[model samples]
Target: MVSFLFLDFDGVLHPQYDGEPTPKEVCFCHLPRFEAVMRRYPGVQIVISSTWRQQFGMLQLRAFFSTDIARRIVGITPTYPADGPPRMHIREWEILQWLKQHHASNKQWVALDDSQGDFRDYRHRVVFCQPWEGLSEHRAVQLSKALQGTRL
Candidate 1:
């Protein structure tokens, strides 16, 4: 069975800060380490759960990663409709919606994000990243361990 990986760009792939960022804190600076871990899990497909998806086309988003990894990005989560009822854990809701829409609700899945509270109800499926450090060495290890423990 294929597994899903819900991905957030800011605060997960790079530093998320209120102040001006240093030159070294460029976007996707930590992607190499993330990609390294993901390489071991070929069965895992990615779904962008980040706000970046609202600004970029699928092809543009995929361009950020290597060709191999980019191809594994199956899709992006749909944003909640403005007229929809109020909801907490919106990101989690979006992921679930995607799963249902794709008829993949039975697939094993995990989300990589820095906003822990956003996935409070589904904490088990989230591998939280540090906002300032993004996918630091520690977060990378955590991701590996999470994947190893997953059904995938």
Candidate 2:
């Protein structure tokens, strides 16, 4: 199956650690765990579902990861001008919009996000991550199961 992952960086990868003057890289405490899952599932393609894609653009965003993970990134989610304001959190809308463009009906997909809002009907597809813990072993197990078409 050609599975796709809609990735969120701030919460899913690590905590936002709001206003602490921390460098961006300092927030990523779970790359090894994340990388382990990615290594286990090399077939799954990644789409940038994080707002960081808007801030830094694709190339720079991909630069945040190792070269191997970078190759798995198929694309970034689209932002619509009609959706209004750059800072607005219309992420679920953007992910769905990107899915629409890509003909997603037959695809297996999942979103890793920290927020509980904004999913609507697609709530079943989300695997909630604990922001404070990042991609802990427990959440990684959840992610793996979700990708394997097991119960979320």
Best candidate according to TM-score: 1
How would you encode candidate 1's per-residue C-alpha lDDT over 19-133 as one tens digit per residue?
A: 5553564978989998999999898899999988999999999999999999999999999899999877899999999999999988878899998768766788889888887
In angstroms, the error of model 2 at 50 is 0.7
Give stretches of model 1 more than 4 Å off.
19-25, 150-152
Clash totals for all candidate models: 0, 0
Listed per candidate, the RMSD to the true structure in angstroms reads 2.3, 2.8
Clashes of 2: 0
Show pairs that collide, candidate 1.
none
- The TM-score, computed over Cα atoms with residue i paired to residue i, of candidate 1 is 0.91
lDDT of 2: 0.79
- The global Cα lDDT (0 to 1) of model 1 is 0.87
The candidate maximizing lDDT is: 1
